[model samples]
Target chain A: MASSISTVPHRAGLGHRLWQSRIDYLFLVPGMVIFGLFILYPLFASQWFSLLNWSGFDANQAFVGFANYAELLQDKYFWDAFARSFIFTLSTVPAQMAVSLVFAIILNNKLLRMSALFRTLIFLPVVTPVAIIGIVMTIMLSPFNGPVNIGLLDAGLINRAIDFLGDPNLVLWTLAGIFVWKWVGVTMVYWLAALQTVPAELYEAAKLDGVKGWQVTFFIVLPMITPFAIVIALISAIGALNVFPLIQSMTQGGPYFASEVMEVYIFRNAFATLNGAVPRLGYASAAGVFFGLAIMVLTILQIFAVRYLRSREKPNGA
Target chain B: MALEAASSAASEYVIRQPLITPRVRRWIVSALLAAVCCIWIYPLVWMVSASFKTNAAIFASEGLIPSQPVFDNYLRAWNEANIGAYFFNTLFVTVGSVLLVTIATAMMGYVLGRRKFLGRGFIFGLLVFTMFVPQGYTIIPVFELLSMLGLGQSLWGVMLATTGGSFVIFVLLFAGYFSQMPDELEEAAKMDGVGFVRTFWYVMLPLSKPIIVTVIVMQTLYAWNDFLLPLVVTLANPAIRTLSVGVYAFKGENFVDWGGMTAASTITIVPVVVLFLFLQRYFIDGLAGAVKG
Candidate 1:
């Protein structure tokens, strides 16, 4: 679309046309400058830094070509962190999408009352900082003394307080649960917006044909919102891959690094001394580059996959 | 006779299905929704209630209400924990970043959406591509850049970093908005001999109030809640730390000060929630616009 727009021919001389469009360039100056200086520069620079051996502090840097990348490939902890990150993404994205879809569908009902209040309340968590949620949840879900355990124990649902953060097996899943709880509302909002786009006339027609609720939702509503579902899934997947502050504040990838995701792994290596290890900026950069490229590839693939599905479905539906 | 007939008709309309009536269905749905709302809101309510309770009471009691609420926690969190300083620092960065983003993105969106120019597609595509790059990937070089600029460990440095990244959403929102606007207004301004920049300034910009508000609200929530950039950039400086970082530090410092910690959490979160409640219509609409566009 933008290419076509830019391809429009002008009868005027090239210099004159360029002069006429100078204002457009003027408007783009600040955005382009900032993007170049901050976003673009850092992006490519990280790739270069990945190939060099440099402590983030020292000016005396060693140019070790591909050594950092090679180390990352052999590093067990890096691969473990990558696998954990992948697991986190897989676990949270689908669960968050499902829960958000359910909430959105419920709230979309015309018979539902006080929907705005429910939505506002649900979305409250999204506005709260993840770090704060981590801290509060850490205390709220603390074993032996936390309210969640206390409530469960008092109700006789459990005999003992569950070690939500301390137990290695439970910690990652627990973080995923908290993440879903916090972010489901944003996805709900997205689904709600998509739901509104499904014309009411279609529902009326379906009802007139004596189509039941679940069938109508399955055949009509879901298909109508499939594009939105794809976008939401993509965004949620990327977001889950970037999980950091919550883990940092809550567990710091503790209990033997069970909850450590890619971002926390990168942060710990690049900035902080962890477990008697000095900061490894180069190694962290390599990990970041690898993870980033993986995400980019995944995103591109998902985009194409969604487009193909949409095109295939177009024959039978609008 | 007419009243009796109307009453009888109303009774006829109230006839129910065999399994469940419409009224019963509505009641069931409402009850279920209420239950879900309660579950969703429980943690926030717990946070607020626990903020007023003693540390022992917070752990001992599972109730939403405190046995004997006090203001001491808030007082301590505000005065001793230096939450007030963090609040100001967060406010400064959020405001600065929002202002910069709103202005820059609005102008960029205007040009990209309205003007036919060279490399427009390339610029827009680049922005879109950056959206997929995980934020953490950029942190290393961004830190290095800030250090080179001598802005590291400062709130302004954090703001610069915050404003630097993928604001493509705002640009997309504004562009989608501006494109939909009829060209007649700009054409009229052109006929009146208004220059392109002036036309955007005097006419298009004034008409962009809704999108502007949307960008401001969304960006405010983003900058205010952001943790990673501030944490990284201001790692060496505790004095300029944002609320999120402050609360995280407080947890480490006073491990057992649950009341003070919750109080600090509530303090940081409440303002955003309140702001959201007031401007939710614009916020939701803006978000929908961004997604749909």
Candidate 2:
């Protein structure tokens, strides 16, 4: 996109000496100061601690060289969490991408009335806090007298009530389904916004070539919106990594750690104070640093992969 | 592909397409979509309906609308539950964080967007890098840092913990507006010995409204609904709990109150929902900004 639009900036600055220019960046101090104090500082500070053996307090801390990272590597729970998070990202992202894409196509049909109202309703769950979502899902999916189970029972769908969150065997997939429902609409909004930008003329041309319906969707619409698709995928990936509150409220990583993602595992060990003491700050910090690095690597790889694939495409070739 | 599908569908239909006209098809699709939409929204409707019902009526009225909608649940949520106090606390914290994020990110964004300073590219990359840093990965250090800074177990700690948000800084990459903005008004103001601060206040601030509004809306929503921050840092102090935290407080160790929970949840979300209804246009526009990679 940048290469395609490269040239002169429409809002030209005077090409005078850099020092002599009137564009003084000194005006940006107050905001920078806040970001520096709160955000930028904490990250580097965390990295510095990742190399130390401090239990989150400075008084009796020791600078243990890579001991935290070494311990993290050997920790069984850490690897379990990493694997669960990968499974979560795998199960949720592609399903959400597919459903959200269908929603976008339906909304963009132009002839549909009440689409705006439907879009707004679909987007309601996006702004609802994850904590509440957890409570609502837990109650609704409860085995006895909960509306969901009752509806299924009345329909003769099941002989006995199912523990959606309590059964370890069926828990992760159940959580995945709820996660998809909550976010699929959010992703649909992104898709709808991106879809509007795809010009109508391309569709008419495709129709003239005897292309319509699913053929037009696959051949014409999909390729045109690949850039937007890549963006939504990255957003979904980042979102899955932070799936904390919903799990914490509903299950608390119960059913023998079957659904524990990295976020919850870190919180449980680092902040919960559940076993009658302060959470393991140093070890948890190491886990956090490890996960952060992994995310950074994944994001960079995704960007590179998308760019290379996009470049390999011969304009519109399949 | 077209021939395969078209021929199959045509041969499969036994009535030879003697059935529905386009008008009937349109109405049928609309009605079907409406039913699905209802199914989609049933959870939300059920929640609201349950919130208005008495304890027995909630379980009894499960099949349809509440038989006799009562206001006691809402009253209990408002007064006894203290959701009102939590709402105020949440609004204050969220507004404070959003202001801090916007002012800080905008100033930094401006410098990175408009200035040719030292390590400009490095700073820009660093800011972008922060976007991928999740709380799951940052909370351990953050919990330590907040306590070390004497802000833990307080509302202020919650405010400070969200400072590194990258959503604000990313807005700076689209500095086309700054490069495009006419300097005549600022030049005239500066010619009168108006310093950078005064010039920014009287001139530059007015012009950066679009992006500023976007930052405000996005940050406000995040701060309003944020649970993990308050949950982690302010657990010891119920007084410091935000609306999100207050809603979770209704969950007891022995049992959960579904009616009270939904009542609290409804109360908690009303403010954000009201804000969304009011700023529907600006909210979408702000969200569109986040969508731009």
Candidate 3:
């Protein structure tokens, strides 16, 4: 049916063809307007905002040519936040992918009954609000009387309650663990979908070859789902870098800026005053532009990397 | 008779040998996964249980079941935090944004998917590229844009802001669905002398139920759970705050009211969880399609 429709001649002129498809243009109008205004415009407009010295409240703003960028280059707090953000991303993405892959592999087993129930239970956190998760975790991980501390003491793992969110050394890792807990379900689902696409014949053939379970998983399953693995990694990395409300609700980047990440840093500078520091809208905009461009570059690199990997694999009959 | 019985037992042993290992292994794995699932959902279960417990019980007991359940937390959370007002506000924004996004993206998706129009690829590419851009970085400008348009501090502004942020996801889902749809129905409508808009409104729109549901479910969760946008845009007006922002404020104001706070948090997550439970399949499929797209 599609072939027949495509084979029909379009003998009309270009202008006439466009005119005939006026309804299509009309269909696109509203989405385009909103997308252009809210999303696309912000991509460039934020860069413009980054160049100015404005408090985000005053009307008279100084036209500082690259001054914010210059200041951003020398700012230690900005770089510290950036490093912390990278750490959060690095820690969570791998942990999430690893745990989720295991879950996906187990759940993919044909003989696993009540799989639906397990999947729903695991995914419950994903649907819950991040702020709420943060709040709950804050309570659950409280140093003195939190359930986690109580459980640890009861289990004889520790004699004293450790301040999970209070200690500078432990805050970031705790936050990363919490992030993995919430988001592993999402990555697991992605892996499950990817796992289903792997041919049954391959697994059967491997079994016929006397391949062990771990070997089959590592050699056949892992390589087969590499594309999805890479995509999941990139998505999680990007998401982790943008962690905000979780930090806000839980720590507010407290304990001497130990848990501070790029988004929270930007939020602090742009809107809220934290620890007696004044709001720096211009500096935050500059930092935002920097991080935004960094993400764009990372995405482009990922696209290239994926294409390159696919190209390399195609010769081997991928 | 002894020899015959021995042979039958030997045969049964061989058959069981081949099957017993994997069946046992499968059960072990299922049991392990069930344990992991409990750990994963423990926080949420704990939260719900704690919402019912008295403050003393919440701190003292680490168990799932409450020793003595009380309804006071919910009452205080509802009254003190003005949760009812915030719930209504969240519902209003979520519904408005979901409806607007569904219609707008459906129309856009139809064009981009089914038609070979000028600049379609370019516009689609632009939209896809915007997906990678960190939206958190742009909140300041978005806040300014909303204020400039005089929609700031209003639920309508929050709705509109949320609409375009993830607009690409719905568009991709809808476009993928529409592209795969058979063209014969639309062609038949054309043969009957129906106009293009009529064909879309009557034929294509009606046929887009699945994709529409996916979009609605996904967007509803997003708009309902969203915090940062509403946080920034509704800063001036406390009356227009959504559940998330209101709950955050509740925490800030009553720093020690963990009971009430947990109660409010429970209230905030219930609607999304209920909707997800009802539309579980669509939610999973939509998420898969979104990531793949």
Expressed as tens digits, the lDDT of each residue in B162-199 for candidate 2 is: 65554534445335445456657656876798976677
What is the number of backbone collisions in each predicted candidate, taken in the order shown? Answer: 0, 2, 0
Which candidate order results from sorting by DockQ in descending order? 1, 3, 2
The residue-by-residue lDDT of candidate 1 on A42-85, one tens digit each, is 78999999988888766757899999988898988889889998
Which run of 10 residues does model 1 chain A get worst, by summed lDDT?
A1-10
Among residues 3 or more apart in sequence or in different chains, the pairs in candidate 3 whose N, CA or C atoms overlap within 3 Å are none
lDDT by candidate, in order shown: 0.83, 0.71, 0.82
Ranking by lDDT: 1, 3, 2
User: Better model by TM-score, 2 or 3?
Assistant: 3
lDDT of 2 at B201: 66
Best by TM-score: 1
The residue-level lDDT of candidate 3 at A224 comes to 81
lDDT of 1 by residue, B121-178 (tens): 8988888788777778999998888888888878778988888754877888788889
B-chain TM-score for every candidate: 0.91, 0.80, 0.89
Q: Write the per-residue lDDT of candidate 2 for residues A1-318, one digit (tens) a residue.
A: 132123434444545333433344454566566556656666677787777765555675778878988988998888998888889889999999998888777665544567667777777777677777887788889886788888888899997888888899888888888888888876886786676555555655555565545666677667777778887888888777777877887888878888888888887776674657765666777788888888888888887898788778756654
Which candidate, 1 or 2, has the higher TM-score? 1
Give me the displacement of residue B202 in model 1, in angstroms: 3.7
> lDDT by residue for model 3 over A14-78, one digit each (tens)?
78767766778888889988888888888888888888888876574677989999988898988
Worst 10 residues of 3 chain A by lDDT: A1-10
Q: How accurate is candidate 3 locally (lDDT)?
A: 0.82
